[model samples]
Target: MSGSQALKADALDFAGDTATYALSLFVIGASLRTRALASLIKGASLAAIAIAVLGMTVLRVMNGAPPEAATMGVVGFLALSANVASVLILLRWRDGDSNVRSVWLCSRNDAIGNVGVIVAGGVVALTGTAWPDLLVAALLAGLFLKSASAITLQALRELNTTGASHATPVESSS
Candidate 1:
């Protein structure tokens, strides 16, 4: 790829990664408002992992080789951690509310994405090519975008129903 192409690719990757982190805040924030403590903690953890991955990927791109590989190794581990934690947390959620289910689905999607990241990292290490790394980064961003949209929509729905009650109000006999 030419210098401009490489730069564009990097820009896209960073933007996506940043958006992923930003969405994590929403997840964590929504979980807090809903009083889902476990989900909150998990969201926080995932956010941290995402930041680490972003940092590492940037460092790898700029630095090169062994260091890049090392960072990719860390990304792989963190990806696994994020996935496992998300799955476990989602499993504990009892309510089927759309908001909660949205969160659960995000976790489920992320877990799958994490596996892709791991594979991409391994491929990069084996082949010493940028494609694998870039592919994974793009895939992660896609996953983030998908989850963020779902969560935001669900949260809006929840907020819109603020005054609405599932149960009927009792009528006064006056």
Candidate 2:
């Protein structure tokens, strides 16, 4: 809602998260392979979100936009608190399936990103520059990339294992 570049990027991140969680919910109870597929989708979505944030940061840098530091801090705090709650709720389901794991990972990454935003807000306030906000946005993007890669790898492994087990016929006992 805020026109500040950082806040806008943060909003986009939240929107992406909402979509990711919704997808995860739909696939939570699916088969192992299906869950793995969902995880892959989530990973791709995370990567897309990161790329989008980075792109927005670059554009803001080019345009020399300075976000309102106080607003950034306030929003960051609120977002962090919300993400912490989401993470706590998803923590138990983290090891359940690929879909659930992806949900947990997304929530965890969001919390960390929110902290970065808060720090960026403080730095921006002190320096009166947009660099801190851009830096934080980039860092958050990197975090998203890291989590996406990890989730995707795990999902691929699960898919392979699940597929192989199904394909291999069990030996009959004498």
Per-residue CA lDDT of candidate 1, range 1-174, in tens?
A: 221212222334334445444544565545434523333333344344445455555655674443154455555467658667867977875255444554565556555665665566567668877666655654554554555455555555654564354557889999
Alpha-carbon deviation at 48 in model 2, angstroms: 1.0
Task: Estimate the TM-score of every prediction.
Answer: 0.50, 0.89
Q: Name the runs in model 2 displaced over 4 angstroms.
A: 1-3, 168-174
Candidate 2 residue lDDT tens string, 1-174: 433655666676788789888887787678889889988988998899889888888888887766788888899899999999999988898886677877788888778878887888888889988888888888888888998898999999999999898896889998
Query: How close is each model in CA RMSD to the real structure?
Result: 8.8, 2.8
Stretches > 4 Å off in candidate 1? 1-67, 78-82, 92-95, 102-106, 163-174
Query: Which candidate achieves the best lDDT against the true structure?
Result: 2
Give the Cα RMSD of candidate 1.
Answer: 8.8
Reference-based lDDT, each prediction = 0.51, 0.82
